[model samples]
Target: MGFIETFGIVFILEAADAMIKAADVELVGYENVASGYISVLVRGDVSACMAAVEAGVRAVENMGAKVYSSIVIPSPHPDLLKITQIYNIDNLLP
Candidate 1:
């Protein structure tokens, strides 16, 4: 999985687009942390995920936007996925 943290909706959209275009990756979802802090999540093979994240960071920087954070998790634990529900949120409903 890969994550990109930005400060605005425009940045998030641009970053996400660049990331996906850079590699074969899927956008899991996004989270709005409030106060203009937003996080985008993506999932794929380790290499692709890494490349996507790097591309996203570059996209934001090239656009003169700030990237608060970027992370690539090669192999997240199944239990962690269960807790985060990154790839699927429908399961979270009771």
Candidate 2:
């Protein structure tokens, strides 16, 4: 799992675009924490998640947007998903 935090929805969308295009990853979702702060999430293999996050940061920087935080979790705990519902598994069910 990877997370990229930045200001504004536009910046977050740009980051998400760069992330998905830079590697084979699935965009879990985003969280708007109010006051223009947003966090984008992605899930994939460790290397891919790293690359995606790097690309996302670069994209935001290139747009003159500050990246509040970024991280790549190689192996996140299953319980974390249950709590956050990052994967939105319920939406994927048939």
Candidate 3:
């Protein structure tokens, strides 16, 4: 779990991961919650996690994926935590 923004700043997902990796971020885990939907789980500060999501979104968009909506999320969401815990994932890079 992490915090990305206190007020509101979005990075798109792909961009956030790229930027975080470039910054040498070592995430504890990353997981996808839904099928055919671009969502993931990672461990870091809320702000950094938010950036990762944005970075992912950017990468998808760069590959020509259409973005319909975007939103900032809270780190403690039960669904997200559940997915991360069940997967036993850790240290996401790229």
Candidate 1 Cα outliers beyond 4 Å, as residue runs: 86-94
lDDT of 2 by residue, 1-94 (tens): 8999999999999999999999998888899978999999888889999999999999999999899999998877766756567546543211
Model 3 regions lying over 4 Å from their true place: 1-38, 67-72, 75-83, 89-94
Ordering by lDDT: 2, 1, 3
Q: What is each predicted model's overall lDDT from 0 to 1?
A: 0.86, 0.88, 0.46
**TM-score of every candidate relative to the true structure:** 0.87, 0.90, 0.47
RMSD of each: 3.7, 3.2, 8.1
| Model 3 error, position 40 (Å) | 2.4
Which prediction has the highest TM-score against the true structure?
Answer: 2
Q: Candidate 2 at residue 13, lDDT?
A: 99
- What's model 1's overall lDDT? 0.86
Q: Per-residue CA lDDT of candidate 1, range 1-94, in tens?
A: 8999999999999999999999998887888889989999888888999999999999999999999999997767666656567546543222
Off by over 4 Å in 2: 90-94
Candidate 3, residue 32: lDDT: 34
Cα lDDT tens digits, model 3, 1-94, are 4322111122235544564674333445333324433333345555765665566556656756554444544535555644455656543221
